[model samples]
Target: MQIGITMFATDYAIPPQELAVEAEQRGYESLWFPEHSHIPTSRRSPWPGGPDLPKWYYDTYDPFLALSAAAVVTKTIRLGTGVCLVVQRDPIYCAKEVATLDRLSDGRFLFGIGGGWNAEEMEDHGTVFATRFKLMRERIEAMKEIWARSKPKYAGDLVKFDEMMQWPKPVQKPHPPIIVGGGFPHGARRAIAYSDGWMPIGGRGGDTLAMLPPFRQLLKEAGRPESEVPITIFGVGMDGDALKRARDAGVSRVVFGVPPEARDKVLPLLDKGAALMRDA
Candidate 1:
């Protein structure tokens, strides 16, 4: 399994470019940045992670811009959007950003996407809260059409557009891998239906290791091979047993969540993770 790192990419953290270079130098396979356009201070919707959302969620720099900085600074480490909320953005503009980033990074982009959790946040973007899942699927489908065709158009219940042309087509043939993110079964099913990869938060419901076989079974039942739709589990802890279990479960990648902190604080963790990678 490929081991990597993910961070919130806040203004106070080790900047994305510096972290990318350091991660590459430490033999980390990839560097992932999470995105949240804006955090509403209303505190109406409960945070999925906990009672209080971290300040980094509101302070995050735009993932595309941060990853662009990372791309210019580093050559080998793969770039990723840990969980870009596609439901909250305009797909036409996002398609352009994805294509441009993929081109600039020389086909090194991994598009990890989600429907998001904050109801008020989605509402602020003019997206319906209850129907966000369908909207996300449609947006993803529309973006694929945009990436694959010279004059592309999509007519979905939620997302529709006339035939249009966009430049700087992604270097990755059909566009960057769309790694769908959500909870089990539903998210996994969406991945099988349309996305190129599956990204589930580890321990969201229970043990992530225990869930993979059932996920694979679901793929088999759908006539889709799990191998074709790779799994990348997020929030994996750095440990021998966890790593072993993740590998045994056939995970394509496991990303360790890092705190948005200074270089002095973050680099030591990267060193330890790289050491574990070597030991594993």
Candidate 2:
């Protein structure tokens, strides 16, 4: 089981570069940063976690910029967005950013994305909340074209672009490992459809073990071998039985959540988590 850390890159927390270096030195395999382009004050959408949303949601730094900083400070450790809001951004620009980052990081980039849940936030991006999933799919498809082809063109209900030339193709052949982030079975189906992997958050009320059979079936249905898709659990806390269960369910990676605290306070826990995961 590969161990990694995920944190909200907020202005008040330890800088991303320092956190990345610490994790890399301590034998962590990767560092994941969450994204929230900007939190709207309208409060139209209830917080998914609870009734009240956390303040950090509004203060978080751009995941791409934060991960880029992390990438430069560490070698061998992969950098990724824990769950980038692909439903909110222009796919063409996102493709460029992702490819550039992958090249700069020596192909150590995992693109984890999701159709976010914030309704008003989606509206702010001019994306319909009802069709957000469809938009995300087409956006990812469009981005793949930009990444894999010399002169790419995409025309669909959501994304339509003429043939355009873009340079600095990703160092990873055919682009980076796109890890679809969400709970099953809808997210699992989407992952099988277009992503290289599935990143499901722990404790999302999903039958983690049972999820695999259907997920594998979906992969097979999509004409992709079951072995081709990796399952990674995000925000996993230290629990021996749970880890065993996840491994038994064929989870390939486990990302522990790092508290938004000072470096000294958080780094030790991260180190302990990494050590335990490695031993597990």
Candidate 3:
């Protein structure tokens, strides 16, 4: 099993590049940053965690820019978006960003994506909350066509474009791994149908272990080889028993959350986590 780290990349946090270098030196497998294009202050949607949503959600840096900074500083550790809200952005622009980042990072980019929960936030982007999942699916499908075709064109209910030229294809063959992020059957089915992996958020009202077998079964039912889809656990804290259970249940990666703090404080914990994984 591979151990990785995820951070909010807040303005007050240790700079992303510094964290990336330290994580690489400590033998971490990857560095992931989460995204929120902009948080709405309406507070209409209840916080998934609690009544008080964390302040870091509103102060976080753009995932692409943060991960790009991390890319230039580290050679081996993969850079990723812990969860990019595909429901809020244009797929064509997103395709360009993903491909460019993969090129800049020498193919070490994982595109973890999701249909986000903030309804008011999606409304601001002109996407209906109820139709966001269908839109996200179409957007991702369009992006895949753009990445793989020389003059790609896609026409769907949610996405339509004429044959257009886009250059600098992703460094990773068939594009970077599109890891769908969410919990349970809906997200698992989406990942099995189209994405390269499934990233079930830990600590939510979801059983990462119990969900795995059903996810594998979904892949088989979808006419996809189960071995092709990797299972990643996100926001995993440093719990030995949980980690062991996750691995025993066939998790490929566990990304521990790193609190926004000074590098001196965070790096040691990262190193300790990496060492524990190595020794395991």
**Alpha-carbon RMSD, each predicted model:** 0.9, 1.4, 1.1
Screening candidate 3 with a backbone cut-off below 3 angstroms (N, C-alpha, C), the clashing residue pairs are: none
Lowest lDDT sum, 10 consecutive residues, model 3, at 271-280
* Model 1, total clashes: 0
- What's the best-to-worst order under TM-score? 1, 3, 2
Q: Candidate 3, overall lDDT?
A: 0.90
After the best TM-score superposition of candidate 2, give how far the Cα of residue 175 lies from its true spot, in angstroms. Answer: 0.4
Candidate 1 residue spans exceeding 4 A from truth: none
Per-residue C-alpha lDDT of model 3 across residues 179-248, encoded as one tens digit per residue: 9998888888888888999998897866678877777878878888856789889998888878888888
The lDDT of model 1 is 0.90
Q: Among these predicted structures, which one has the highest TM-score?
A: 1
Q: Candidate 2: global Cα-lDDT? A: 0.87
Local distance difference test, per candidate?
0.90, 0.87, 0.90
Error of 3 at 63 (Å): 0.6
Over 33-132, each residue of candidate 1 has an lDDT whose tens digit, in order, gives 9888888889899988878798999899999999999999888899999888999989999999999999889999999999988998899999999999
- Determine the backbone clash count of candidate 3: 0
TM-scores of all predicted structures? 0.98, 0.96, 0.97
The candidate with the higher lDDT, 2 or 3, is 3
